[model samples]
Target: MHDFPDIDYTQRFIFDESDVRGELVALERSYAEVLAKHPYPEPVAQLLGEMLAAAALLVGTLKFDGLLVLQARSLGPVSLLMVECSSEREIRGIARYDESLITPDATLQELMPDGDLTMTIDPRQGKRYQGIVGLDGVDLSACLSSYFVMSEQLPTRFWIKADGKRARGLLLQQLPAARLTDPEEREASWQHVNTLVDTLTAEELLSLNNETVLHRLFHEDAVRMFDIQPLVFRCSCSRERSANALVSLGLEDAQQLVIEHNGTVEIDCQFCNQRYLFDATDVAQLFAGGGVDTPSDTRH
Candidate 1:
């Protein structure tokens, strides 16, 4: 195992002479925090970590105020894998898998047979946009590459790696006609950068710092690096949000649940495993359109 620094951030870089941009993300504490909430299998954890890194990388490329979610759904052992990265760089992820069906060495195709990847961009003040692509590629990185090629009509490539403890990703994309306008030059530049990036191994991608990795890969190219943006593991679930969920159940149904559970109704957040208990009085107050005080016990 590599002794990585206590860092979790994403940095953007652009080629000075070419019309290409890129982002590199390295996640350690945020990845560990998400895994601590659930006892995921090794393969499941690795895939989830990769998804977390992928979400962060994609969100860095966009200019939205809401969130970017990367989700995969299938009918195999791993039923669902979802990761969300807010515009503020807070991330949370969860995985659903059947223990009995999971093998020690299950490939992505075996674990997620018939799966499809969905990229959703939800802005704070506009309509949400979503793009779906079939899981035709062997791994998450390849699937994402196909998404950009088909949906966005941009030439994009990704190098993603995860080992249950840390996750890192590198993305190279060709922007619209800018510094390099000639079509032939654009193609040549894209190919040249991608060809060099192809030499990057999973070990190097997961272990090296952004500067070292960039230098090792593109030392001769004129690259402009940007400031790093911090990322953290933060579940969106809160006591207020849980209370709103009880309200959505309606007073009658909410009261019945409280009665069936011996004067208390417990709501557990799947992503963070935090419990929210509403007793008879709390339920009544919620129904009365009054504020409900905090629960007696809360788990972090």
Candidate 2:
């Protein structure tokens, strides 16, 4: 149980005789990488980290081929907050918030008073699908659980918490195929597990090891934990991709952008805060050639 690398691990477990399924994730570097890009306010950073962790937990439990995006669109100064996780386990996120709205006890409703919480699943070869609902819960975990109830039509629950250094979450879902029959024993077991899990404070979940936490919650039950998977922090942005975006905007606009910005069209990655600059010569070569090459950045 302790031989795996400590990046992030999501494990599927069962109670041996019950139809209930569960997942647990402990994120270390993945959570910190998302927060390292910008100096977000304390609450905003924690909320974003929790979303990222919850996304990983969700994706790990479900079977999807493409990317899954958990997004909230609001009308407040904090207009949008998004967390995207690909089927391959790559994750990235960004949060927008109003500096004036910053408060010690700000909540999800305050940040996004009139927004919709949505989960969009885009498969690589099939039509994209989306499930939309209002922001009914106070936090991301509850909001996402609401989505699970509607879209998945399953009895699901999520517990997520995070800080600047790390993020962690647990997901419990009833398998659809196994839900046809009502087993009182299984339901009672789930309730018992839930009660013990409920006792897990945010501090304990954040500080304790995964095995210890699982044992603390389900020590009485015959739970079977599976293999661990590594969850690493990664960014998808590249200079070539940025240049391609510029090209797609049309050479006229690219040139105009360079001129307006004094000889360079600079694009910054919101996830990493890395800047990609294309100058006159860069633009000329991009148009002269059908494809653009990735630019080299001198800034460390």
Instruction: Provide TM-scores for the models.
Output: 0.96, 0.89
Model 1 lDDT per residue over 117-197, tens place: 999999998999999998768999999999998986678899999999889999998999989899999999999999999
Candidate 2, position 262, lDDT: 93
lDDT of 2 at 122: 89
Worst 10 contiguous positions by lDDT, candidate 1: 291-300
Candidate 1 local lDDT, residue 109: 95
Instruction: List per-prediction Cα lDDT, in the order shown.
Output: 0.91, 0.79
Off by over 4 Å in 2: 1-5, 177-180, 183-189, 294-300
